[model samples]
Target: MNPLISNALKKDLELYFSEDDLSRNLYYTASLPHDLVDCKLKLKDDLLLAGLPYFVEAFRYLGDTSLDWDYFKKFEGKTYKKDEKAEIHFQLPFAIALTGERIALNLLQHASSIATYTSKFAARAKDKGIAILDTRKTTPGHRSLEKYAVRVGGGYNHRLGQTDLWMIKDNHKSFFGGVKEAVEFFRSMKGFYTPIEVEVHNMSELEEVLSLGIRHIMLDNFSPEEVKRAVKLKPVGVSFEVSGGIRLSNLDDYLIKGLDAISVGALTNGAPNVDISLKYNR
Candidate 1:
């Protein structure tokens, strides 16, 4: 596991095990059915496998480490069609395994959903070399895991936080008075040399931002023809990204020559959950 992810997973697991909270399985765990048992995981719907590492860690926390929990995860990040199954052999007190099932399954389902949605978009740009990026529009606490799932599906992650990049959005312009005014304040602040991206709502905004000599520009809600025109207007080495209201079916239409990337907000914000269930051996 990546050290960063391992560390973050540890912190997230702490929240699950919080003493001050009885939210997850704290109430049930108090009365464990003290006998060993085995279980398997089965899929009801098709999806890209994800969150196996997290799933493994979740069980690691619930079951005794000395016991045999020989879990073989060869399908994570790969597609699993309907009716597929993966067997896991773990010897844990019946209640210990049962109590942690919901939390563990919730994480796996959510991550698999995001990965599946991202894979559709990522596949569109694979041959073109154009990038597919996930927006910061993600579930509040699940951003890190959600973004990690995006990568699992072959998509690239955008800014992890506000500090990673400098972005000038329409609201930032409204708050700071105008596009140029916001740009000036951002420039005079004297911070790290982060990639500066400005969102352009129309041709005027696009031209205005272009005159500022910014390397990266986002064509927010622009039509395909308009994006084609904007692509022509951009100078050499300028990176152009189109965002807003793009769907998997129509994404290919937007990939014209010179277009650098497309940003999809739905990758994390609105992906549907993948259906999976845990089965215990009788």
Candidate 2:
């Protein structure tokens, strides 16, 4: 597993156990047998599968370490139709399966939803040679898994965190008085060299950043026409990305030819969870 995912899974499991109370399986402890049992996950809604690794890991973390997962491994990233049944199967102790079910289903449903939604935007952007990127607007404690789903759905990830990229947004520009001052300050820091992406709110700011030799730029909240005009002014070797207010409904309007990427926060923030359920095989 990726380190980011591993770390996230650890934190998520810790929280899950804490909130759900590890010692309480009420009915399972009261009367149900703790014997190993076969189980199948029912896909009640059509969705592109994602987070199987996280789902599997949840069980592993909960002490179902010897599970035979070859059956379900093949389904990751594959789309399944609604009411699909018997495709995903596994076995674990009844208590462990019941304990891990919610966490597993939550991860799978949420990640699959993001992945499914992202695929739509990614497909449209691919036609125009533009990459669909996910922003930092992700669920708390699920950034790694959510970003992973974005990739599974064929979209690219922007900065995972502040450290991944040096993005000078409008606030930074405002605080430093202008783009030039902000860029200079970042450039002057010794041993702090990293790829810098500056967000320009208008053509004037774009020109100022361009004049300073900054190649990576984000046209924050620019409309289709405005973006086209900015692209026309784009110099050779400069990459332009647009973010803010871009959505599936108006995605086509922003698929300008010269734009390199279109970052949408909704990919993670607005995606609804796909429905899924776990049923024991009696």
Candidate 3:
């Protein structure tokens, strides 16, 4: 495990354990009926599968036992016919009815939903010279997990957070006079080690940042036409990203306008839980 994840998962596990310790096997010790063998997960509709590892991990964590995990997909990095089955094959190691089934599915369904949405968007952007990007508008404390699902769905991540990269947004724009002043202030701090990206809301600000030699520019809330114009006016080798209020309905329009990347907050914020069920398969 990455040190970051090692530290974080340990903390999360401790929290979960503490919260349920009062029950003292009230949930886990319930005797399950005979002949019930395995729980198999099935998708209600075709979906781009993701977060399989996390689903298994959550089950193992809750049950404090292991079960076989079986995965089946018709294709890799592609869509599937409707009504396909995605299963998690496993049997309880003991005849104990698990109490955390709902919680386990909650994580699986939500995470898979983000991945499915991301995969759909990424598929549309594919071969169009545009890359699908996810923003920081993720569930607090689940940023790493959500972003990991984005990658599994074929999308790229923008800066993980402020600590990972430098972004001069409108708030920063206010502290300094404008883009030029902000860029200058950061440049003057010569020892800093991060790429600086400035947000430009309109053409004038775009030109101002370009002339100041900022390597990256973000076009917030720009229409497709405006995005194209920004791309045309940007200096050679300057990277541009588009963000704000993007959705599946209008994503292609922006891609068609030739953007280098587009960040959709809805990937994590507005995700709809994918439908999955676990039932006895045998």
Off by over 4 Å in 3: 1-8, 13-36, 63-65, 68-82, 94-97, 188-192, 280-282
Encode model 1's per-residue lDDT on 87-206: one tens digit a residue: 435555676567667778888888999999899888878888788999999887788788889999999988899868788999999999999998887887677687788999999998
CA lDDT, every prediction? 0.81, 0.85, 0.71
lDDT, candidate 1, equals: 0.81
Model 3, range 1-282, lDDT digits (tens) per residue? 123533455555445446546367655455544344677666676666665555555555654444434332222234443555555466653343244455556666776788888988888988887888898998876786788878878899986887566788998889897777887777776736778888889999998888888888899999888887788886778888999888988887888544688888999888777787767533
The lDDT of model 3 is 0.71
Cα error, residue 247 of model 2, in Å, equals 1.0
Predicted model with the maximum lDDT: 2
lDDT over C-alpha atoms for residue 27 of model 1: 61
Could you report the Cα RMSD, in angstroms, for every candidate shown? Answer: 2.8, 2.5, 3.7
Clashes of 1: 0
Candidate 1: C-alpha RMSD after superposition: 2.8
lDDT of 2 by residue, 118-190 (tens): 9989989898999999999998888988999999999999978986778898788889988888888777664
lDDT of 3 at 167: 84
TM-score of each: 0.89, 0.91, 0.83
